[model samples]
Target: MATVLLLRHGRTTANADGTLAGRLPVPLDDVGHDQARAVGERLRRLPLAGVVSSPLRRCRQTLRRALPGAAVTVERRLTECGYGDWEGRSLSELATDPLWQDVQRRPSAVSFPAGEAMAAMAARAVAAIRDWDARITAQHGPGALWLACSHGDVIKAVLADALGLHLDGFQRIVVDPASVSAIRFTPQRPFLLALNDTGGDLRALAPPPGAADSADAPVGGGSGAR
Candidate 1:
């Protein structure tokens, strides 16, 4: 089996301020850098095959600090959901909107006013995860350790797919900022090993000692309005 770790980028200025960053290029704040280092230091012990990240500045920043020495790539498919008119807006400002209510409870039925469809977002996110999982396993072996750092909604969509849940239920899957969720992919089904794990004890993912794998030893915040 091949494993993939889905990580939400660290807190950005928008996140810290409760703004919907959407697909904007918001940079991580000071606390975000600290959060990135905490997760990075923990995962550094693993034999990470590589790192894939959203092209957004915040995610790129998080990936750089979290896996300083790993091979990295910018995957547009892993970018955050397009929040359209809601971009850069505060949650309190949109709390009473009918679309917000629909999105929170019945996402599959609603599409952002001038942005992406939730169904399409979930489809592409799942596709990207599958593509990366296969590529990492083929390049580094089945017990490969790799990461995809993305946003709250994107990560939740992937997790919902892994659990065979419909897109409408995706909101139920919480992905805090800088959190990690583990998934093991097989021909049969994708198995979820962890969800929203902010703690740093992921050493079990590394291959056993001297197991022919190049390796070493072992190792949130709120879900933004992504």
Candidate 2:
């Protein structure tokens, strides 16, 4: 089995103001940095096979601080939704828009006013995970752990797909910033091991120190989404 840890980037000024950051270059706020450090400390105990992150500054910073010396690959497929025209807008401001209701109640049919489609986001994200799962499984073998640090909606979409839930139902899934979720892929089936696991203490899922560790191995890197 190959396990992927979906780690959402920490808080930012937009997040604090209930704004939609979209693919902006928003940096993490003080609390977000603190959260990243805490999550990092908890994750450092595990011997991760790889650390992947979105190219966004906020996510990149979070991964760098959390994993410290671990080499991180930027996967654009794991980017935050392209909120397009809504970038930097307040959540409260969008609440009255009829599209907002559709977003929360019928996400599967949503095509942002000028942004990415919900289904498209899920498709690419899921595809990316499948590819990474196979690559990591082959390199580290079964029961190995890898990290995919990305945005909240992105992680929720991954969670929804793994749990066999409807895309619209993804709205019900809460993925807080700096949270950790796990989805392990096995030959027999896919497993949803964790969701929004922010308390850390993930030692139980670790494959033991030096157990299939790939710290010295280099993984590919590239530009990523916010």
Candidate 3:
């Protein structure tokens, strides 16, 4: 197993406009670039085994600034959930729709008209992350760390899965633009190391010597990350 950093793409033009960008090719706004660079500064302290990204433009732009010269694997499964008829619509306006209630309270059952289902989005995202985690561990050893830049809802779904929460409760998890959530996968289960972290020291995420292969939790929360 390996550690995976889940990064939501920086804010975009649609975000500032309160619109749902969905799978549209929206690029990051000016503030987003600054956020990306700041996260990059923090991430530079760790040695990332690999970097993967959603195929969407905003995600790609975020990674381009965050990792600079790092090679990025474009994963379609990490792309934004298709909002279908809701695409490019203002969130304030969508809130008035009858379907919006379902989206807010029971996302597991939400299937955007002419778009992808919420359950389906969660399935693919968790699968992609688990698969990539396995690959990174195998290629670079259990201590390896990697990153995946994706959309907000998609990342929230993945985090919900990691937290062992039902999709209906996903809205409770807020994934702000450019924030980072971390998870470490093990044979027994996945451990959520961080959630919706906007600004925090990430160096502690690197495994300590001789500890990478252990999946057991520290007894009594033995010595916090060094």
Candidate 4:
């Protein structure tokens, strides 16, 4: 029954342009850096037992700014999806391409000319979350609270698996840049405390599991498709 907080990294130059950045290793832009600082300032006071992040530059950069001194661990499995040939292309550019348009509706069947299958991305992401859960529990304790800095696609896939939600259902939930999605687990099951919470005051963003006034936490929504 550990508490897992999945944090999507801040925006990047590609993000601003609506580009697909799977395994692209793009770093945060100036705006992204500022957003990460704001996010870090917001969550600085949270009672996090440990911090973990994907090895990708974007996730790493966000973690460095947000959790300055927290014991940060690099998790390769949590890296963003591998978009293959679609790597730096914007959505609009891909729209004109038949392969891109086909994948939009039949994600499971479509793959970038050189990219990964959506199912594979979803599977790997789930595996990473399961591994992370086991690793955290083994190292910290069953009830430890931890934060994971990761990519949007990875976060969506992990949550979909953890909550037993369908991939289509996942497409209905959106994860905003630098947003925090809080999930808490008990011996019985897992619950989503909040989703896509934007910055206001980090302290007011979301409450830890078992907090008395968790009912007062803020809320936001969008399809989790990123």
Candidate 5:
């Protein structure tokens, strides 16, 4: 299996304004562009086999600044969770709704009014990532690395799945804008290599030569980072 880097799109006007821009075509703010550029610099340290993005404007803009002319595949399944009636509403306002508590505490059981269910979002996202990882491994080899730029909630759900946590506990995972998390899939299970990493050396993520693709975890975490 290949390593996949999950990148949350940069901050947007809705983000700064405390609005839920769910499924809306919101653009990134000025700060978002700077953040994207910075992350792009860090990403240049590793050789990414490919980049996939949500079919949203903010994500596309972020990638434009992050990877420049890099070809990006737009995946509809990676799009922001459908907020339905809650789209473009302020978060503070939504907090007063009865469903808000469930969203924070028991997301697995809560579905947005006229929108998609949280569990459904998690299912589609995990499936998309797994499929992409398999495809990348087949085309680029097991040691290959790739990236997916998506929304905050979608990334959180994916991370929760990778960490073997129930969807209800996903609220505990915080995916800030422009942050990057990493996961490596093997025959046995997925390993979370990084989480909500805003700044760190990413070159260590590259597998060393002759490394086995489906190597199992060492009893004591093996040698740290080769």
Candidate 6:
């Protein structure tokens, strides 16, 4: 068995403003950096064997701080869902846009107009998790601790796959910036130990300002929009 830690990336300029970053390469702001540092401090106490990250800058940056100097690997399969034309657009903007409305009404049926399908994205994300799990088991014996830094969409997809949940349940889970989710894997199945935990001492490690969406605020927002 191996312990897999799923880490959401720190806040980005778009995330703070409630915009859809959607595969956009947004770097972390000052607060995001701080959050990453704080998360790193907390993880230092864990027996992390390896670190993996999405190719996006924000996710990469968060992983750097959370597991500095640790053996890091970049997996494109872990990248966030591609929003297509809505990559950097806001919800409000999409609400008024007909295509955006189509995306909302039938996301699984609709592509980003020119973007990737949700099913494909989710499958890729799951594949990445499974691949990482296999790698850990092969390299560090069966009981290993491996970390993956990814995004809301990708992480949610992984969660859905691990927990036998549906895509709609993606909104049922809350993965905050710098928050941690853990899973244990055996040859037969994967077990969820925790989900969306942000209980670390913020006095020494506060989340960066605007790192989270106000739609899901007050610490545990209880899973709002994806």
Candidate 4, which segments miss by more than 4 Å at Cα?
200-226
Cα error of candidate 4 at position 207, Å: 7.4
lDDT of 2 by residue, 77-178 (tens): 998888778788899999988889999999889888789998999999998888998999889887688999999888999899888899989998999989
Q: Tens-digit lDDT track for model 1 on 163-226?
A: 9998889888888889999887777677677899898588865544333232221225323212
Write the residue-wise lDDT of candidate 6 on 134-209 in tens digits: 8886887555777899998788778877888876556567888888887766665676666887765322222223
Q: What is the TM-score of each candidate against the true structure?
A: 0.89, 0.90, 0.97, 0.82, 0.97, 0.82
Root-mean-square deviation of every model: 7.1, 8.4, 1.0, 5.7, 1.0, 9.5
Judging by lDDT against the true structure, name the best candidate.
5
Cα-based lDDT for every prediction: 0.83, 0.84, 0.91, 0.74, 0.92, 0.75
* Candidate 5 segments whose C-alpha is farther than 4 A from its true place: 210-212
Query: What 10-residue stretch in candidate 1 is worst by lDDT?
Result: 216-225
Model 5, 113-141: lDDT tens digits are 89999999999999999999999999999
Write the residue-wise lDDT of candidate 4 on 1-226 in tens digits: 4567889998898998798887877889888898898888877877677788888889988988887767898887788777788788888897898876556555666666676777788887777666776677677766566788898877877777657776645665688888888776544555676678776544443333344223332357522312
Q: For each predicted model, how many residue pairs clash, with residues at least 3 apart or on different chains?
A: 1, 1, 0, 8, 0, 1
Q: Candidate 4, 176: how far from true, in Å?
A: 1.0
Global fold similarity of model 3 (TM-score): 0.97
Backbone clash pairs for candidate 2 read 55-224
